[model samples]
Target: MKGYLKAHTHFFLPSEQMAEYLDLPEKTSYSALPPAGDSNQVLPLPDSALTLFYVGGIGAHYKLNAFIDAARSIPQIRVNLVTRKKQWDEAIASYPTFQSPQIHPYHLNANELDDLYAQSHIGVLAVEPSDYRRFAVPLKLFEYLSRGRPILVTEGTEAARIVSSFNAGWVVPYTAEAIAATLRRLQGNRAEVQAKAANAVSAAKVNTWADRARTVADTLTGKSK
Candidate 1:
C-alpha cells in the first residue's frame, strides 16, 4: 500500500494526522481536503438565550449527558437533542434530565433539520477523543456552518481547528464544566453569537461544493500541486 500510494500522482486526505498513518515521503504528500457544505442553507440569527442543537446518537459515546449537565446550569438556555425516536425513548427512560423541559427531543427528517437549526445558536458535536477522531471532520460540523450556526466541538479534533480557523465557534472540551462555562458566559449574548455566526457562514462559503470542485481541479492540474 505504501508503494502504491508513493506511485500515485497525488493523494488527498482530510487531515494531516492521516499522513502519519501512510508514512509517505514528503514529495508525494497528501492534500488536506475536509468536508464541505451547501450554500443554499437558510441562515438565521442566534436565539435570545444561547440555544444549542445536536443531531445524531445520544448514547454514552455520544456524550448527550455532558451536554445535559452543562445545560442544567443555565435554566434559561435550551438543548435540542435530535436523534432516533427509539434512542430518545431509551435515553429518556434512563436519564431523568432527558425528560426535563429544557431538553427538547425530536425525530425529524434530514430536510427538517434546517428548521431546527434556524432556531438554534450553536451546533454541538460531542465526539469522544481518539486518533481517528483527531483527523476526521464530521459532516454535521459543516451543516452547522452552512446555516450560520456557531459550532460547539471538543478540543484535540480536526473540527476544532476548523472552528478556530474560521472563528466560527467555540471549541471546548467535552466536559460538563467546560461546556457550562461557555454557555453561561455567552448566555443571552445574542450579539456575540450573531458575530461568530457570520464567520461560520463565511467559512461555509469557501467549503461549498463548487469550492471543493475547484480546489480538486486545481490540484489535479498542478495549479496547487
Candidate 2:
C-alpha cells in the first residue's frame, strides 16, 4: 500500500505500522516537557492533592462520558474535562457522574488547558473508532508524555500500542470496570506509579516532535527513498 496524499507523517507512520508493520526508518526525537521551573512560575492547579485529566471532543462520538463515569468510582480523583465551550455544558449535563463533587468538569482555554496537563498526575485519552479519531494522534498524547505523567489509555487501537510499546502507561479495554481497576492499582502502588511516570517522561525526552517532523520530511523528500 502507498501513503495517503493528504496524510502527515504522524498519521502515516502509525497507520503504516498498524496496517502492515512497515519498518519506517527510526529517527532521533525529543519531547518539550517543561524544565525545572523558577520562583516566578505559578502552578495553577486546585488544592486537590491528586488530579487526573481526561481530554476528548465534546461530541457524542469521543466516549468521554464513559471516562467520567469511571472516574466517579475512584476517590479523590479530580476529573477535569478539557473541551471547548460549546460542548461543555451539554457534556456536564449528560455526564453520568454529573453531581459528584470529585468530578470537576472544566472547559479550559488553550493556556489554561496546558496548565491542566502540567499539574495532573495521569492523562487519560478517549478516542473511539470515528471519523474524527481516525489517523490522528491527539495532542494530549504527546502533551502527557512531555508532562512526564503516567497515561491511562483505552486499548485495542493504535493509541494502546504506542503507550504499551514505549512503557509509558497502562492500556485497558474501554470499560468503566477496566479503567477503574487500572486507576485503583496505580493508587495502591505509589512507587509503581511514579516509576511508570518517570519511564514515560524518559521516553518522551527522546520522541520529540521536531525530530519526528524531520524524519517525515526526509521520507517525503526522497532522503529515505
Give per-model CA RMSD: 2.2, 6.8
Residues 73-159 of candidate 2 have per-residue lDDT tens digits of 887677676666667767667764555876666766656766676667777874444433443456667667766776787766656
Give the alpha carbon lDDT tens digit for every residue of 22-81 in model 1. Answer: 787777756888888898784777435667899888776565677688887678888887
Where's the lowest-lDDT run of ten residues in candidate 2? 30-39
- Name model 2 segments beyond 4 Å from true: 1-14, 17-48, 127-135, 220-225
- Which model scores highest in lDDT? 1
lDDT of each: 0.81, 0.62
Q: Name the lDDT of candidate 2.
A: 0.62
